[model samples]
Target chain A: MDMKEFKLNYYEKLYLARHFEDELMKLFADNKVVGWIHSNKGHEVIGVSLALAMKSHDYIVPHHRDRPAYLAKGLSAKSLLAEIMGKTTGCCGGIGGELHIMDVETRIYGPTGVLGSNLPIALGIAYANKLAGNDHVVVCNFGEGGSNRGSFHEVLNMAALWSLPIVFVCENNKFVEFTPMQKHMNIEDVARRASGYDIEGIIADAFNPMETYETFKYAIEKARRGDGPTLVEAKTYRLDGHYEGDPMKYRDEEEKKYWLERDPIIGFKASLLNESIANESELESLEASVHQVLKEAVEFALKSEPLKVSDTFKNVYA
Target chain B: MTKINFRWAITHALDEELARDDKVFLVGQDVGESGGVFGLTRGLYEKYGGWRVKDTPISEEGITGLAVGAGMIGHRPVVEIMYMDFISLAIEQLANQAAKTFYVSGGKIKVPMVVRTLAGGGFKAGIHHSQSLESWFTHIPGLKVVYPSTPYDVKGLLKSSIRDDNPVVFIEHKGLFSLKGEVPDEEYTIPLGKADIKREGSDVTIISYGKSVHQSLEAAEALAEEGICAEVIDLRTLVPLDKETILKSVEKTNRAMVVYEATKESGFGAEVSSIISEELIYDLDAPVRRIAGAFTPIPLGDAEDAHFPTVEEIIKVAKEMCY
Candidate 1:
C-alpha cells in the first residue's frame, strides 16, 4: 500500500475504535448491553500501531481494556458486542463476557479478568513458537497497574532466561483502577522494571501513532531475530472512567481536561490532515464509514439470539 | 510382566510418551540435567536434550503458565510441581488458565497438559512439603484428577493422562513411591475413569485410592481371615469417578466405607459417602464410614505417623459395619 493509503488505513482503525467505545457506552445506558464496559478511548493508538506492526501469523495476548487490540487482531465488532451483551452469537458463545476476548484463528490468546495473568501465558505462546522454530513474535499488552503484579516480574525473568520471542507492551495510563500511579508503586516509569530482568526497554509517546508504530516494529523485528523479549512502555491516558458508570470523584477535573486535549483520535486526525495525506472531505468520509460499520454491528448484536441453557454446559470438557 | 517400583513406572511412562510423540515434552525445576528432585526424569534429559526436558526456575506459576500456553497451541506439556504443597503457588494457572482454556475459548483451544506432583504424609515433611490436595482439583470442573496407588496403575493412567486432550492433575504418593508392582514390559495404557477391584469379597465394601488403597488391601486380608470377607475397590481417577462400579460393589456387599489419607473435614471421602447415601442408601445396611486423617497440619518426624488412616482403622471400620 502507498503512504496515503497506509495513513488512511491507520486513521480509519483509530476512528473505528473511538466510535466503538462511544457506541458501547450508549448501549450500556440504554440497557442493550450489560456488565462493566471499559472504554479504551485514549489507548487506541498503541493498540492500532501494535496491530499495524504485527504479522498475521504472530499472536497477541491483549489486556481487558484493549477492545481496540481485539479488533485490530481480527475480532469482529458484532461478535465483541454480542459477547459483551451475553448473546449466543458472541465469539465465545457468551461464556466469556467483556473481560475475556479471544480469536483462535487470529491467534488472539486472551485478556483474562485477573490482571497481569496473561503475561506468563503469553510467554508460553512465545515458547511454543520458539520450540516450533517459527519466527513469530507474541505481543503481550497490559497497563501500568499490571506491572505491579507478581506475574509480570516472574514472566519477564523467564522470558529473558529462555530468550523467548515476545514483546511486553505496558500502556501506562497512570492509574491503578482508581488510585494514581504515585500511590501504587515507588517507581514512576514502568520501563525501568525491564532492566532488572536484563531486557532492553523503550518508552514511546502513545499519542503519536508513528512513534508507537515504529517502536513496536523495531521490537517485533528484534524478537523475530531471536534477540529475546523487549519491554516497550507506551505513555498514554484513559479518556473515560475506569469503567462505564464510574463516578469520577477520584479523578480531578484538571487531569481529565489535560488528557482530553491530547486525545489520540483527534491528534492523529489533525496529523493526517496537516501532512496533506488526506483532505477534510476525505477524513469526514472515513469517519462516516466507521460510524456506519459500528451502527450495523450494534444492530447485529441486538438481533443475535440469546444463549441457550445447554450452551452453558457445552465445552466444559473438550 | 515385569516388576518395577512406583517411581520407575512413572519414569518409564514419561519416557515412552516422550518417545512416542515429538510434541510431548517435560518442564519443571531440576527436570532437565539433574533429572527431578525424586530422580523421576533421570536419564531422559540427556536423551531428549535440554529443550524437551526443560529445567526451569523456581517459578511455579510461571512454568505452569508456560505449559498451559504451550498446550493451548497443540504441544503436550507435562509439568512436575516438585511437591503437592507447592501447588498452591500455581493453582491460579492450573485452575483459571489451564482448566478453563478449552471451555472459555468456545472449544477453539485445548490445554493438553499433565501436572505431576508428589503428595501424602509419613515423610515428616511438615505442612509446606507434604499435602493431599486432590480434593482441590476435583472441585474444579474441566479438570481431571488422577491419584494412582500401584506401579501398574500409575504407569497406565499416566500414559492415558498425557494423551488425553484435557488438563489432568496426576498425584503420586511419596510413601508409595518405593512400593513394587507388576507391569507389562510391552506398551499399554489404562483409561482414566475406571476403578480396579484390588480384593473381592461379599460382606462390606471399602473404596480407597493412593496410599489408602494399600491399607485397605491389608485390612481386607485381615478381614478375610476373620470371615468378614471385605471387598477393596481402588478408584484410579477422581474426576471421572467410576460411580457405577462403586454402586455395584455397594449393592453386593450391602455396606460401604470410604478411606483416604487427606483430612476428614471436607475430604474426598465426604463426596464418596454422599454419593453412596444419595444413590444406594436403601441397599446399604449401615451408615457409610469415612476413615481419614485428623483435621490438623501434618506434624514433623514420627509424629506424622498417626496422621494418616492406618490399616487397623480400615479393619475396625469394616468389622464395625459387618457385625
Candidate 2:
C-alpha cells in the first residue's frame, strides 16, 4: 500500500488508542471501573507502527500498557470496556481483568500484569509456530524496565540459540512504576543490548508513525522468513503518570515539554496536514467519530453487571 | 512383569512417549550428557538427538515459563528441575502461570506440561538440595501432584502424566531411586487420583505415599505378624487425591493412621488426616493419627534418615490405632 493509505490506517488507529485510554482514565476516576488499568496514551505511534509492520497472521503479544497494540490487533472496544467492568462480554470473560486481555484465537496471547513475565511465553509461541512449517513471526510489546529484568536476558539468549521467529518491541517509556531508568541502568537505549545476542538492534522515533512503521517492516519480514528476532527500541513517553493518578515529579520540565511538543498525535496530524493528505477539518471529524465509538463502549460497560461468584469456578476443568 | 529400578522405569516411560509422539521432548540441566542427576533421562539425548532432548542453562524460571507457553501451543514439554528445592526460584511460573493459564483462559487453553523432579531427605543433598515441599504444591487447586513409590507406578504414572491434559508435578523420592520392584514389560498407563492398596487388613488403615508408603507397608507386615491387621493404602497421586480408597478403608476398619516424610506442622499427611476427620469423622472410632517428619529443617543427610518418619514410628502408631 501507498503512504496515504498507511497514513490513514495508522492515524485512525493511533487516535482511537489515545482516546480509548483517556476515557478509561476518566471512568477510573468516577470509580465506574472495577480493575486497575495501565494507559499507553502517548505511546500510540509506536504501537500502530509496529502493528502495520506485522502480517495479519503474525503474532502480537502485548502488555497492559500497549492499548494501541490492542486496538491495532482489532480487539473490540466493547470487549475491552467490558473487561474493565468485569463483565462476561470481556476478553478472557472478565476473569483476567484489565491486565490479561488474551485471545488465543487471534494469537494476541497476553497483556500479562506481572512485570517482564511474558517474554519466554512469546518465545515459546514463536518456536511452536516456526516448527509447524509456517513462517509466522512473534512480536512482544513490553517496557524499558522490563529490559533490565533477568527474564529479558534469559529469553533473549534462549531465543537466539533457537533462532526463533520473534521480534521484541520495547516501547521504552522510561519508567518501572516509580523508578527512573537512569537510577538503575547505565545504558540509554534498550535496543543497544541486542548486540550481545548477535541480532539486529535499532532505535526509532516512536512519535513518528511512518519512520517507526518503515523500521519494523524489515524486521518483521526477516523474522517471518525465519531470520531470527529483532530488538526495536521505540523511544517514547507515557505523557501520564505510571497509572491514572501519580505525580510525575521525576520528569524533567524541559524533557516533558520536548515530548509534549512532539506528542505522537499532533506529530502525525501535522505531518498529514502539511502534506495535504487530510485537512484539519478532516482530522477534527475523525476525532469526533472516535469519541462517539468510545462513548458507546462506555455505555455498554456501565450497563453491565458483575459476574456471579459461581462463574469464578465455572470453567476450571475444561 | 519383570524386575526394574526406578530410574529405568522413568526412561521406559520417556521412551514409550517419544516413540509414540513427535511433539513430546525433554529439557533440563544434565539431562543430555550426564543423563540427569539420578540417570533417569539416560539415553534420551542419544536416541532423540540435541534438538529433541536438549540441555539448558540454569534458567529455571525461564525454562518452566517457556514450557508453560509451549504446552499451550500443542507441544508436550517435560521440564526437569534438577533439584526439587531449586523449584522455589520458578514458583511464580509453575504455581501461578502454568496453573492459572487454563482457568484464566476460561477453558479456551490448556497447559499440558509435566515438571519432573526428585524430592525427599536422602542422598546427602544438603539443606538447599534435600527437602520435601510436596504439600505446598498439592495445596494449589489447578495442578496435579504425583508421587510413585514403586517401578510399576513410575512407568504407569509417568506415561499417564505425559498424556494428561494438565500440569503434573511428578515428584520422585530421592531415597527410592534404586529401590527394585516389578514393572510391566509392556506399555501401561496409571490413571491419576487413584490410590493403590499395598496390603489388605481389617483392623486399621495405614495411609501414605512415595517413600513412606513402603514404610507403611513394612509397618503393616509387622502389624500382620502381631495379628493387629493394619490395611495399607498408598496415595499415589497427592492432588485429586483418592479419598475414596482411604475413606472406604476407614469405613471398614474404623481407624486411620496417616504418615509422610514431610514436616508435621503442615504436610501432605495433614491434608489426608483432615480429609479423614472431615469426611469420615462419624465413621471412625478414634481421632486419626498423623506420623510425619519433625517440624525442623531436614538435618545433615547422615542424620536425615532419622528425620524422616520410619517403619518403627509407623508400627508404633499402628499399635496405638489397633488398640
Candidate 3:
C-alpha cells in the first residue's frame, strides 16, 4: 500500500488511457468505428489507476465506459480496434463491439452494455475466487446510474452477507445519461449507501490519480486478506455524452465547462508537474509514444484479415 | 438400477456432481433449508453447506447473471428457477448475456451453468403460474434446452448438462416430480442430441416429451385395446433433439402424431411435425397429426382439464389417422 512505484505506474497508465480516449474521439468523428461507443475520457484516473493496482490473478468486471481499464489490464489494441470495426478478427468476433469487449484470460470481463447486471456477476466471480482459495479480488466498476438498478441492492446484500472478496468501484460521474444523480435518488455520496450493508465505504477524487490508486489498493488488499467487500466511490465526470452521437442538449453550458476544467488527464498532469516527478518534455515524449501504439493499432486493425462467413461454425464447443 | 422418483433423480445428479467436483454448486429461491420448491434439491444444504448450496435473493435476473459470471471464472453453477413461468423476468440475462457470452468472446470464455425449472400446466396454477415455454428457449441457437420426462433421463441428462461447457436449460415438469422410474445407480450420461424410444410398434409413431410423454403413453395403451400398435418416442432433450429416432420411427409407421402440453398454435409439436414432413415427406401415409393444449391461458384449478389434451383426444386423433 505504501509503494511509490505503484503510484507512478498508475499515473503513467492513466496517461495512456487519456490518449486512447482522445484517439477514439477522432475515430468516432471519422466514422472509423461502427455502432455506438462509450468513453472513459473524464474518468481516466479512476479506471487506469484501479487497474494498475489490481493483481494479475484478480478479476475485473468493467462497465462499457472503462476502456482504459480493459486495455491496461491485458487486451491488445489490435483486437479492441478490430472489434470496433465489427470484423471477425476482433475479440469476441464482430458480435461484441465497444460496449462488450472483454479479455477473459486476464479476467477484465464485461465491457457490459447493461448497466447494473455486472454487479452480481462480479460478486459471483469473487465468490469463485474465494472458494478456489485464490485469495484474489474482483474489481467491479459501475457508474452513478447503476446505483439505482435492482442488481445493485441484490448484489450488495448478498456480497455483504456472504462476505465476498470484491471491491465495488462506483464511479459517481454525477449523471445517468442526461439525468443528474440528484434527480435519480436523494443521496450525497453513493459510497454512503454501503453503510446499510455493514461494509466499509470510502469516497475519493476520481481526477486525482494518486487518491484513486490508494482507495483501490485499500479495497483490493482488504479482499485479498479476506476482510470482505468494500465500496469505493470515485467522484468523476463524463466529458462526453452517454453515446458518441448524443446531442446532450439537456445539460447547461456551464455544467459542461465545469467538468471540462476538471478533466482528470489535465489534473493528473498538473499534479505531476507540481510534484516535479515528471518533466513537460518527458510528458510530451510519452504522449508521442502512446500515439504511435494507437497508430499501429489502427494499422493492425485495418490490415487484419476479415473473418470468413463460413468460419461462424467454429468455436462453439470446447 | 435404482427405482427413483424424478425429484430424487435430480437430487442424485446434484449429489453426484458435488461429490465428484469441488467447483459444482447450486443456488435458488428455496434450494437450501427449504430443500427446493419441488424437493429436487432435497438435503443439499445440509450435505454441502452454504458455500456450494447457496440461497439467493428473489431477483431471478441477478441469480442467472451471477451463475453465468461465476461459470466464467471456473464454477459449475446449477441455479434453479422456482417455476418455469418466472423465467420471463430473467430472459434478458439468460438469453442475451449467458447464451451469447461464449460466441461473443470468440471462445475465450464459457458459460458452464445449468438453469433448472419446472414447466407445464398440470398444476392448474392458472395463466400466471402455468406455462410450457421450453420452445421459447429452443429458438435460440447458442443455448442447449433439455425437457426430461423420465427419471432415467432426468438423472442422466442433468449430469451431462452440469458437466457440459455451455449453458443448458434443464426444464422439469412439476407434475412429474413424484413419478418413479428405474434409474441406474452407476454414474452415466445420455448424450445431448440422442432421443429415446419408450415403446415399439408399427402402426403409427407418437412423438412426445416431458409431461406429454406420459400422455402419449396413455394414448398408446388405449390404442392397444383396439388392436392398433403405436410406437412411443420420448424426446428427453428438446434442443439437441433426437430427430433421428423420431424420423426412423415415422418412416416405419408411415404416420406421425406429435403431442405436447403447450398451446396447439406453433407449439414444439408443430416443430416436430415440420421436421417429419421435411425429412420423411415421401414416406408419409397420412398428414402428421398434432394433439396439444387449446390455445388459451391454462385455466385456474381443475377447469384446465378440458383445454389440456386428454388421452381420449390423442386416441381420437390417432383413430382418425388409422382409418
User: What are the Cα lDDT values of the candidates?
Assistant: 0.90, 0.83, 0.83
| CAPRI class assigned to model 1 | medium
Q: In candidate 3, list every pair of residues with a backbone clash.
A: A92-B104
Evaluated with TM-score, which candidate comes out highest?
1
DockQ values of all predictions: 0.78, 0.61, 0.59
Per residue, candidate 3 scores C-alpha lDDT tens digits across B1-323 of 87888889989999999999999999889899888777777788999998789888797887888888889877999999988889987786778878878877777888899999888877878987788888788888778989989999999899999999988999988889899999876779888878889999899999988888898898899899998899999888888788889988998999999888888898888899999999998999899998888988888999988887788888998888988
Error of 3 at A213 (Å): 1.8
Give per-residue CA lDDT, model 3, range A173-245, as digits (tens).
8779878788888897999999999999999998777778888988899988889999999998787778877
* Candidate 2 per-residue C-alpha lDDT over A1-318 given as tens digits, one digit per residue, 9 for 90 to 100: 787777877788988998898788888999887767776777888777877777778777777677677778777788878877788877777787777777765667745677778887887777667656688888887889888778888889888878888899898887878777888799999998999999888999888877888888888988878788899998888788887777778877788898888887887788899999988898888888888989999888888766778989865544
lDDT leader: 1
How much DockQ does model 1 earn? 0.78
Which scores better on lDDT, 1 or 3?
A: 1
Each candidate: how many clashes?
Answer: 0, 0, 1
Better-scoring candidate (TM-score), 2 or 3: 2
Better of 1 and 2 by DockQ: 1
Per-residue error (Å), model 1, residue B223: 0.8
Work out how many backbone clashes candidate 2 has: 0
What is the lDDT, from 0 to 100, of the residue A210 in candidate 3?
Answer: 75
Candidate 2 chain A minimal-lDDT segment of 10 residues = A104-113
What order do you get sorting by lDDT, best first? 1, 3, 2
lDDT of 1 by residue, B1-323 (tens): 99999999999999999999988999999999988888999999999988899999999998899888888888999999999999998999999988898888778788999999999986887988878999999999999999999999999999999999999999999999899999999999999999999999899999999999999999999888999998899999998999999999999999999999998889999999999999988888999999998899988888887888989988887888888
Give the TM-score (vs. native) of candidate 3: 0.95
Per-model TM-score on C-alpha atoms: 0.99, 0.95, 0.95
